[model samples]
Target chain A: MVKLTADNIEMRFGERLLYRFQHLSLAQNQTIHLQGDNGSGKTTLMKMFAGLIAPSSGEINIQGADSLPWWRRNPLLGKAVYLHQHPYLFEGSVAANLSYVHSLCEGDKATIMARTEQAAKLAQLDHLMQQNAANLSGGERQRLAIARAWIMQPKLLMLDEPTSNMDKLSQELVLTLIKDLQKQGTGMLISSHQACVLTQLCNQMWKIEQQGLTSTQHTPTMAKYSNTGQSQEFSYVTAS
Target chain B: MNDGWLALIQQALSLLFSLDPEVWSIVSVSFSVSFAALAITLIPSLILGFILAFGRFPGRWLVTNLIQTLQSIPTVVIGLLVYLMLTRMGPLGDLKWLFTQKGMILGQMLICAPVLVAMSQAAFTSVDRRAWETSRTLGASWARAVWTVCRELKVPLLMAIVAAFSRILTEVGCSMMVGGNIADVTRNIPTAIALETSKGDFAQAIALGLVLLILSLVLNFTLGTLRGKAEPRSH
Candidate 1:
């Protein structure tokens, strides 16, 4: 099923055309890799898709309800989550951040706590759950971001450069987590410069060139890692 | 100069610690009237401040400019306006609010509201837009996003409150004009100081001035502490 669609979207800043798309659709359980240079509107497009901002001219329909408020429209179909290039953590502990999303979920307190615990375990942050999120290292914050969204079980997850400035270990954990999310039939739209890490997981690749989205292709084999249950080490050299 | 100043300070302290009835009554009236005004003005000013900080609408710039202008207007001007509106021949004359504590409260609220709005708007606007966006994208409603912003910027918001309170509490012009400086009715600290000075009661005037000075010092101390503790971007 086509879970989301954007028809003839246009983004303009004053007289300059930033980018435009004729038609775009994300089916259930699909993963689309977005490749673009810095300041190429990749984040802008993601924000529009998430209904955080409105395009200059376009219709974004989610599960046939086009006119519902962005926040309200998500629940009508399923949740849509957008992750910032650098995710923001509330001023509190990791558990507090997780509990924020948990409270937003439709569940009682006990269920919320249980899901929060499960997510912390999945993100390998259980031990640090009581620690302040701001005090966490960069890789830990990235993992926390994934964990924060994971507990919500969004139908469509839009991640903007989730693994840009990380060591190999953090990259593998994020990729592994992305793969896990894919297995659960979540539609993922990811924008990243590290195409080597995403090639194996993304079935379709789209690139922004000359103010338009053009489909591209890449082939890279996945470097398997040992099943040590922690951040797996990888020996793959990422392309410049 | 040294002896005269020291003597005045000594006299002021003696009067203050002695809990002089007339002086204490004046202080009590000042606090009650200004606190009532502060409480009434806080909610609406905060709401307006948040709106001004985040809202995009027609004439938004104009409204902000108007609030900024009001923030700097002399307190005596505000007093005159309130006096006109509350006089027997004025539009609000039926309420007979002039020369009453309630009348004084109305005038102080007018004085404080604009200060609160202007300062708090700046406080809220200083916050990163990303915080609000993240909260909303994560499923918070508009009001909830604002509440989150308030939580994130608690230090600045409290500073705005304390600043507004200080502005209204020490202002003499508005209380004097609207309260008529009536003894045991609406006579407050500032007005009492003015009367005592006019009557050549320098000791009493110095005592009241000392109290106002102490209050200012205490408020500023709190502001300094809050600045040390404030981590507006901690989120």
Candidate 2:
């Protein structure tokens, strides 16, 4: 079992401190929806979790392994994957792009092909498997990027604004897939503005603002009136 | 002008087809020296280019500046300095490189190395950093990462080499000053053209000059095509 933990972390870029958090831990398979306004530290914190940026003053520890590299520190980084807003695609056909990622491995061709298909199905990208990825539409391209990330069999999946370009149906498919994947022990961190998408799937919505990150405790009582007239339950709006 | 051009073209074609041993020898020797110098430049420039692109050191800027400055130093000046060094009483006098094809090759290597380094560093820097980081994260060592980048940037790198070779092959001043146009020995196309033109043998010089222009054009065209092909594909 892999647990993600950060102890008293302060993040800084150049001479400016972005934000600081104390003891952020995910003990189980949790789907976290990070909600924040633009320029708030949501992306920054997600980047830190993805091991793309190291914390200025803190310790990120993978509870099981002591000396693994930062990526390995969180299994998501090793077996997990991060999909950026503008995902970088390799230059080639979909087959070439898929095969290129697997080419570095010592595995058999069948294994690679099977995993590619499996990922394509999970990400609802089976239709465009043969098309040149560069020629895909915006939503198709985002799904293709999702398919690419899924092919990695990540223990942790972090997405920055995934499905921002996807259609409503595609968004539901992705959200359902994320929930299913998380249920099977893959933790997901999705940063998106679609609050309605997460109302059903996300166990918790962590909001980030100029102040800091705050955990909204999701008790069963809160779930009863999610779509009802009780809209004033909590201060859920963050503007400016 | 048309009559003169037609006559020059006819004469050049005849000279080229006559199997004149002098033309053949100079062309052969020039290619040999140019290719030799180009081969010598490849390793040092690759190493230096990789360093300049990726390695950070205290004197990195200074070293790059010096190399770029050397690139602009006229070939004649390079020849004169080399001529001095390899002269009878100079530091490398015992080696006797002056007035030889070896001297020409050495001079061309100096002329081409900096160009290769500058172009290659630009090519390498243009590679995507994601590929670099991915290879490293996947357990490929530093050497492997560099090899991957090189493999991906092969076409651009080849174009740079071709451009360098073409430049060295067409340059006259250094080849003349150092090779001394030693009739059938160190004489190559450009230096021979210079001598032929100076002696008012416009026919022979025109033929050689036209060939030089053709070579330069072909190399430049190939470089442009290769660059176009390699750009969108570069990671």
| Tens digits of lDDT, candidate 1, B47-76 | 999889888999999999999999999999
Off by over 4 Å in 1: A64-78, A196-199, A215-240, B1-21, B200-214, B231-235
| Candidate 2 per-residue lDDT over residues A189-208, each given as its tens digit | 77875444434455667777
**A5-35, model 1: which lDDT tens digit per residue?**
8899999988999999899887568887787
True contacts kept of 1: 0.37
Cα DockQ of the candidate 1 complex = 0.39
Itemize residue pairs with steric clashes in candidate 2.
A76-A80, A79-A154, A80-A154, B128-B235
User: TM-score for chain A of every candidate model?
Assistant: 0.83, 0.78
lDDT score at residue A136, model 2, on the 0-100 scale: 64
What would the per-residue lDDT of candidate 2 be over residues B77-164, giving only the tens digit for each residue?
Answer: 8888888888899898899999998989988988899889988888888877666644443334456667777866877788788878
DockQ scores of all models, one per candidate: 0.39, 0.22
The interface RMSD values of the models, given in order, are: 3.3, 4.6
